[model samples]
Each structure stands twice: as structure tokens, then as C-alpha cells.
Target: MKRRKFIKKSLIGGAAITMPFVLPSGRLFASSGNRMADHVVFVAFAGGVRQQESVLQRYLDDSQAYPSAGNIMYNILDGAPPTDKIVYGTTNYVNGDTPIPKMLSQTLQQQGTFFKEVNASVVGHYAGVNTLLTGNYMFTQGLRNKPLTPTIFEYLRRLTGEKATKTWFIGNGIGNSIPLLDYSTHSDYGAQYGANFLAPIVTFGNSGDKHLKNAKVYHPEEELDPMYKMKYFLDNVWYSQGSALPNIGNTEEEKLEIKQFVRDMFQKKDNGSIAFPPISDSGDLQTIGYACEVLKRFKPTLTVIYLSNVDGCHGNFSSYLRSLHRADHGVGHLWDFIQNQVPEMSGNTTMIVAPEHGRNDDPNGIKDANAFYGYDHSDSNSQRIFNMMVGPGIDSNLSIGNENNKVGDIVNIAPTIAEILGFKNDIVNTGLLASNQSFFDLI
Candidate 1:
């Protein structure tokens, strides 16, 4: 790695983006640098957010709503302590000295920072996630899985020559595609939708990395070489042995049926996998847990942990609060593992936690806030969503808008990360960076 090339921008064309290292394909690029947090763990809250309750804490600041009330997380804490809510839950809108209101309570503590005055273009499912993840509003494409634009992950890979194999997007219904995931430059490098645009060698998925599946199919004697051995074994013995599998019927049709059994062979005991038990059928939990486990092993330079259950909980407000807290707890756990559990990663890593978008302020029971009788996201102030970040050299005890109605735009995120990672690339600066204004200096 050419650590020198990644030095501060003063040396190269007046730009500084990280370390300049040569990629496997022999291209020199800059990376955020190999610090303890060389691995970026982005834990997403994954839902249409509610500012009044959790991160926004509007209900707290306004004494009129509930003079001494606490948000969902603080309310659940053992003593229902005050600091726990403000500190851990970014409880500024509520109270003070509650031990930074740690969401996991067992993990790290600190309010991190909040971007309160933020809004989105749409309240619909895909649009919310698209803008949040891509850092720019993607004009509605009518739910056809169109990404707003390329994402941070794509930029990271290009600047450093890292493959999608090193990145993981853990969610089912997210709207980011090649253009969004890869930033319209290099097509390969996303997990789920990789093969569609790039070759499998560079872009891959969990389906190809399930340990239990490898164990089941290639049992004790056949486990020596999982993929390759399975291929060899099937080639030599599949056609010859049928009666032994008689229940499956001995015919070309049966043979095809038997082979189809391996269709998703060892795809990580997923809901779609044969090895999955009924209890593990819930796709959301399985995905969250599986992706976290994968991160333990690969620890990719860039990773995204997608928790999409929050959107459903939005329809039911109380349940939605718990959902948000649980997701926050999940992020706290990931952060803990990096900062303390894994000492080397302590200050080197950086994390950003935010929701796909804001939910409609619906007092009435309805799905679409914009429906005839309902109001989802108002063109007015209440409809915008907010985001925050914490970890490694980040300013603790700081609040972007310690007060109410503070506006933090979406474009601020990508360039901030790009700036931290030291990417002088033009798009992030021109697109998301320029609009939102990077928060690099603040942290």
C-alpha cells in the first residue's frame, strides 16, 4: 500500500482522501487509512423514523407535551433514569445527566450528535431508503428498485480497488441497485444484486458463504473441499446412484428433482434454506443476525447492517418505539465490539446511524400518511427525518442543534465520510457533499 499517496490533499492536486495503496488489479488509490477502525461499520435504524419519540426527542424539549415524560428507551430503563434517555438516546430533547442514555445500556454511552432539521422528498417506502442510503433524493421511479445514485460503499471500493466481496448490504427490500450501490462507475461490488451487473468473482452474496450449509451438504467425509468437492462428487456419482434414493424415484425427472435440491445449497440457513427451522422463519431477525455474524469473520472495510422491521412498526406507534430502540441497541452492540471488545478497532472505526426517512405524523390509523384522509410527510417542517454519528475521535457531549427546529440536510453525510476517508473524488463533493456540507470538522 502506498501510504504516502493517501496523505493530506496539500500534496496531491490539493486534495487528501486517505492512503494511496495499489489494488489487486494494480491501480493506485486512497483509503480512509488502516487505523483500528479501517473497518467501517454502518448500523442503520431501518424504518421511517419518528422524531417526536426517539432521536429527535421533540416531545422532551417541549414542556407542553409531557412536562416530565421520557422517550421509549429511557422509559424502559431499570429506574427509568433521566440521563440514560438523553445521553444514550440523544436525550437532549428530554432531560440531562442520565448517563448519556445508552440505548443498549450495556454497551457504550454518549449522545453522539443529532441532525434535527432534516427532511426527505417522499414518505413512500423506496424513496425514503433511497435518499437516506444514497445521500441524495432519487426522484420517484414507481417502486421498480431504481437507486437514486451510487453510494458510499461504491466510492470506497473505487478509490481503493476493493471488491463487493469485501462489502455487505444486509437487507431484503432496500431500493439501492447497481447505480446506487456502485455509483454508476464500476458495476461490481454489491452483495445481493452484484451478479446482475458485475461478475460473481468480485461481487458475491451470503448464499455462497453459509457454513452450516457447507457442513450439511458436504458431510464429514465430503467436507474437505466444500464447493469444489461438491462439484466433483456430483459430476462423478449423481447419475449412477438413483435406487438408493428410490423414494425420490429412479428416472431422469427424479434426477433433475434431486439436483434441484442443491439449488440454494448452503445459503446460510436462511428462511429460503432447507436447513432453516420453523423458529428461524422470521426473515428480518435472521437477516440481522446473519449479517452481524458475517461481519465478525470478514470485517470488511465497508459494511451496511440493514434493519427493515421499523417501517412496519410505524403503523403501530408504541410498537414502533420499541422497534427503534431495539435497532439502536443493535448498533450499540456493533460499536461495543469494535471499540472495546476488539481493542485494535477502538478509535480507528467510524459509524453512522440513521433511518431511511421520516414517517407521516399520523394520529389516525392508516398506512399512507399521504392517503386521502391521512397526512404522511407534510411539505412543511414536521415531515423531515434526522441522522447521527459516533465513534473514534468523534466529539462527545456535543449536539448539532442543542435546540429545536435545527435543520441538518441529507447531503452532509457522504462528503463527510468521503472527507474523513480522504476521497477528493468530484461526485461526492458535487452531489451529496456540496448540498449537505460535510460534518467532518464538527466531529
Candidate 2:
């Protein structure tokens, strides 16, 4: 009854604020197999990527005025740039806005295992990403709704007995069902095993900047003003109407730690102590910076970073090219930070990246400033996406699939991540996984 009251009173404007952090009893599906890596970073790469442009390294050949192609995504793969009609928004264009050079020498393809073609069964963004996290094709899952099955976060936390601090989903933004993917609605593994979700830009920008910045602790009865202010703030801003969003299952101690981290981040942002790639305005890059901060502070076992700037392909092709290149730049910086700054996670962590789905076969007739046609996603082009993994135990300079064949499914990524983090058997035995196969087994 006390728990019910706590939830009931916290419900303001139809949204339930996060209850005080606590852990439920017992592990659900404890793992018996040996863990492969100490940590896992799953880059959702949300917003479908196209094959001809991304893995195949074709820049503008498919949907632009130029018939030439080049490797704009230099960090993810090893390929050459387009020699003629180079109008994919490069500073190399001589009249471009920002002169950003492509980092080509030591690409992820050179250092990691790259899958040229991974099948993303679902074409829609919400369903595709849900498929990536749940290892099942969720045809029933819809926009702005929580997943219908257990996410990888729930699997890792429940099976490994890891605390909320050790599992995180750092999203780029809160749109569609992005925020809901942190946890699922499954009866067996639900809110109690969900990951710590921090939409840094969203939280820090609006309410946090005003309420949390340099704020002191307050007693409930002694300082009711601040409490009510916070209540109103959370209810009005953080959550939507009539939505009882699940909270990240952290212990009280972990909650305090996260609070401290947030305070420190605010201070760092003000003092310019936050380390980011110099002079970049992309939201994904900013999110990556905060994700790095979380890794440095908490050293989580699994961290999923979602990047969706590439979704600009829906309208502006030139901006899409720019965003895609900048996304690679952000990813490269993140890997570098892990290697140099976060010493504990430096050598032991495994990083796996794949898009939620791929773009359509042809343009949607939306042209950019450069006369380049923008593309969309559907069942037609969603069949082929790419996957890349780099870390200890993963094969280096290995490329799976080719022009003649497709290799993996987007659903396979979750099981593969589970296998990497020592919970493959547990996840597979749950009967939740579809027809996806782990990379470990494939290799």
C-alpha cells in the first residue's frame, strides 16, 4: 500500500515520476557460460543506412546528380572516395561550409570484423530498432510504445546480476519509441531489470539546467517549495500524458552516484571541462560525449549509444551526407576516448555497431540544395544492413558477405551481444530469440 501511494502521489499530470531506486530479489536466468569481454557497447545506428552508400562505399552514385561514388564513412569501412562530380558536401569541395577531412588510414573495417550485408527484417524505424534490441521481429510494436519483449538490457541485468549502473542506454533523443526501448513490458523480465536511460541533451537542457544546477539537498517537510517545484517540473516536462514510464532500476547508492555525476557534468559543461571533438554541433556527437562521461564515471558493463543523424536522408541528401560523415567522426572520437581516457574499459571492451535498417532502393523525389535526391526506408531496401565489431576475441580485418550474398540478420545482434557478454545460452534458451545467430557461432 505504501508503494502504491508512493507511485500514486508521484503521478502528476498523468505521468508517473521515477520511484526511489530499489532492487527486487533474485536473478532471472543466471548465466553458466564464460564471459567473452568485460564490457559491451551496442551502437544502434538508428535511421536506416543504405548498402550502396554505407558498406559498399558508394557516395552519390545511387541517388544524386553525380554518377561517381566514394567512401564518406571512412571510420566504419576502408574504401576510396569519389574522384569525379564530388558533391556529397565535402569541405574538399573548396566552397564547402566546413572543411572536415576523412580519416581513412585505420578504419574500423581494418581493425574489426565487418559484415557487408545484415538483414533487417522490419523496415519501420520503431520495429527495426525493437528487433535489434529484443532479438525478435515485433510486428505488433508501434510508435511511442514500449517494447513487447525483453530488451538486451533486461537480459544482461537479470541474467548477470549486474546493477543498473553497469547497464545503460544512452539515447540521442526521445522521439518515437526511443525512450521506451530501455525496458520492456514482458511479465518475466520487466522494469526491475531495465537499463539506466539518460537522454543527456533532453534532461540536461530543459529542466536539469534550471532545477539541478548547483542545487542542494532538501528535506521533504522542511523544504516543500523545491520539492513541489521538482514535482511539477518532472510531471510537466519529462513524461507524456497518461504514461507511467518505467524507471531505470538502480539501488539508492547508484542513484546518488548518478546524481553526483549529473552535477559534475553540469559543472563541466559550464567550465568547458567536458571533452568533446572540437567544434561540432551534431546532437549525436554531444550525446556521445555524455556517453563517454558515463563510461568514465561508472564503467558500465553494457552501454548502447543511439545515433540517428543519418536519418536526414529522408529529406536533405547533402545534409544526410554531412551528418553521416560527422557521425563517423563522432564514433571514431568515442573509440579513441575509450582507449586513452577510460583505462579500465580500454582493452577489455567490445564495440559492436549496426544500423536499425537500410534505406529504400530509390530516391523519394526529395532533392537537396545540390540536386541530390533523398532516400527513404521500406521493405524493399530494409533487407540489407551492415554490422561491425571490434575488440578482444573478435577477428580483425574480417569481412562477412559480399556483392553476391547477404550474411546476418539485425535480430542476430542481440544474441551476438549476449554471447559476447556471457549470456548467449541464457538468452537463447529463453525462446525469445528469433532466427538470429551469434557471430561467435558463425565464426
The prediction achieving the highest lDDT against the true structure is 2
Residue 263, model 1: Cα distance from true site in angstroms: 15
Writing each residue's lDDT as its tens digit, candidate 1 over 1-443 gives 36666664446655444565566523464443433236666655556666655554543333123344454444122224333223223223542222323534432224355554565556655565555556666664445554545666655655555554455555634333422333332233232222112211111235445432343333334453465567668856866864332110123333333233333333433455332211222333344444544455445566666666555543443335445555654555566556554455567767776666665554444433212122244434335666666666566545555335546666566665665555635434444433545665443
* lDDT tens digits, residue span 243-310, model 2: 76556668657876887888899989988777675535778778888888989999999999988988
lDDT of each: 0.47, 0.80
Find the candidate with the highest TM-score and give its number: 2
Task: Please report, as a residue range, the 10-residue window in candidate 2 with the lowest summed lDDT.
Answer: 16-25
